[model samples]
Target: MAAPIYKVAIVGRANVGKSTLFNRLISEKKAIISDIAGTTRDRNYAVCHWRDLEFYLIDTGGMGEKSKDIINQQVSTQAIQAMAEADLILFVVDVRVGATTEDRILAKSVNRHKTPKILVINKVDNNRWRQNNDDFYRLGLENQALVSAANGVGTGDLLDQVVTALKKIKKKKSKKNGEENIRTIKVSVVGRPNVGKSSLINTILGEPRLIVSDQPHTTRDSQEIIITHNKNKIILVDTAGIRRCSKKSGDDFEKMAVEQSLENVWRSDITILVTDVSEPLTWQDKHIIDEVIQQHNGLIILANKWDLVKNKDTKEYTNYYREFFGFARWAPIVFTSTVKKLKIGELLDLLVLIYQEKHRVITDNALSKLLADTIRRHKPTKGAGTKHPYIYNLKQTRTNPPEFMIKINFKAILHESYLKFIENNMRYKFGFIGVPIKIRVAKSQNLQDK
Candidate 1:
């Protein structure tokens, strides 16, 4: 089992740069940063790896005596949960505006919980406001507020303080709850609306944890449920139904939900494309698969409602998979009915197998030799084939959407089909099932073409 990750909560009112701070600290724009208040409705979180330490940074909803939207309720609940689960809480504040009546209420709430918090004053763009943060001491968090987050002013010292706080509060061992030696695989159940996606998850989990109905797009946020199979943990993330981008229209709430589901897929290690056998592959199904490809997450296609398929075939089933999604020819396809719970355990086994393949790494010696033989068998017809078409080094630049950077000795451009051939060969040999691969060619002289 992987170690229990530390959680850092960013709690503050909406538009207080909580998301900005989370993005800045992680050195990546994982969260959507916008001028609009309540852009992040829930406690948006992303795991950050720093040196030997790994921790999750959470962005909470803005707190106040008043929040009207249904999304705000979700965010507030998530923020409260974050505080309860945090190894450390960074209470973000806006130093430029100082403190307001709402800020006072939020501060009192934090004080009531008595969670160890670091008062972080944000938007202190200049020394004037940087010095003004001292006034925020009245919030009762005497630790002092740091003027930071946007433009990263006073961030270096803030990070040092954060690391020091983390060291003090972080647990040295994994959660004993995982007392068994088992691997937990995060599986995302994804598909178009009204495809029984939520029903499938609630069925596997043996309860109606997810609010399931006949309504299309019933699930708004990605909800999680854990199931253990022979001591191995399987995390089920039941995502909202994915719709075609072209189909996506107004209703701001719906857009946010779809975005959240996509974000969930990005975090998950493997995704199960749930579809109705009656409908087979639709444009929306292809859209979700494209996203999974882009994210480089593992894929499994579940032809749901198999019980309803009157002409279920033994041979043509594979044909449908190949003809429909040419990209995921190697992905495992399971046919079952969530209503009947048929072959659900088999699906679980296949999910674990797909997850294992996702983490499989190719040895340098093996990959190098394979690349050579593949190129030889299907020699890339070089553009202006003079000069023996120089080759440089081969490096696997990315995984989880397996990609490689092939440094060519010549600056000549290579054919797209040739790159596709190389990618297909890598997939055929390595069993990169349900994942898309990219091959980028660059000119290099110093690097060896290993």
Candidate 2:
């Protein structure tokens, strides 16, 4: 029997080291760390295992202050949503700053949930700071833990407390058989700033789970959300918009946010590249596409804001993307509008299909037959000083973004264009749609076989 996945949320006001604590617990730097307040505008999710217990740890944006700004309101909403969904809450606070008005306000919100919460007094690097905890205790939480998230002081005890609190809660068992064998597909929604990446995800989810703002960089961390589509489990990652701007123009927070966004492309099994259909594809968009191809994950081009575009010719936009993103010709394109909710259902269906395609494996006998037929149609060209290079064998070495190995007489003599030609034929015979195909060439001595 499989155990239920518990959820633990870390909540607090801005700059209280909540993200630092989150990183310390997850044992990875998934969240972008910054001294700037509001650096984390979205709720970041990651799995954490402690004392043989596995549960999800959610890092949420700062709440309180009750600002009238649209972004602040949305950030608060996201945090509240995390609190509502979490089974446990870690109310992190700064020891140096003590408890402020915002802390008191957030305390009330965290208290209303009836969920178990622990008041974590962070930044207690030394005994002097650790001795003073009266102000924090005033917040009225029965449980508290003092730890230095930066120096790894007392974090073990904090985790122990977390385990103890979680043990008290009961978990329900799932009745589905073979649930353990079902693989979760991680799909990352990535694109340039203000291009409706968050909006697109929100439209698909049927709720505003992320903070959608007109301002760029509203999403600084890669927020993960799990959803089931056609009985397939998928982890949707909403990443921050990437920009190719200089350091002087961008801050450290933005730089790290971009780095985290790109890292999601590598971590996910599939990537949905959101583009602004209203404007022509920019160099930055092309750069992002290149990154996805380099990672060799399944790719889906989502041309967003289709309602704003003057020309609605699907064929025109399809050909335009093919011309600009020629490097990723295998990737499928879906023109969608968040406002009109066009093609939202189709996008999810396509995602499941792409996941299946990425994991599809072709048999060696079929591959060998394809190679023989392909070579008959067009023989491999000769090198500068050599006769026609004879092909020996073709075999797929791996799947999940299928990789193939070619046994040739002289690997160096084989041109990349020919390798691409072989890949095209392979795709023609077998469908590897929405996923990148890798071909590896190796020298073989079986020239007489061909």
In candidate 1, stretches whose alpha carbon ends up further than 4 angstroms from where it belongs are 1-5, 48-54, 66-69, 170-172, 175-242, 246-270, 276-281, 290-298, 303-346, 355-450
**235 in model 2: Cα distance from truth in Å?**
1.5
Q: What is the lDDT of residue 225 in candidate 1?
A: 66
Sum up the clashes in candidate 1: 6
Candidate 2 accuracy as TM-score? 0.92
Candidate with maximal TM-score: 2
Report lDDT (Cα) of residue 87, candidate 2. 89
Per-residue lDDT tens digits for candidate 1, residues 322-406, read 7899877767788889999988889887777776666666776777887789778976657654644455546686665566787
Q: What overall lDDT goes with each candidate model?
A: 0.75, 0.87
Residue 239 error for model 2, in Å?
Answer: 1.0
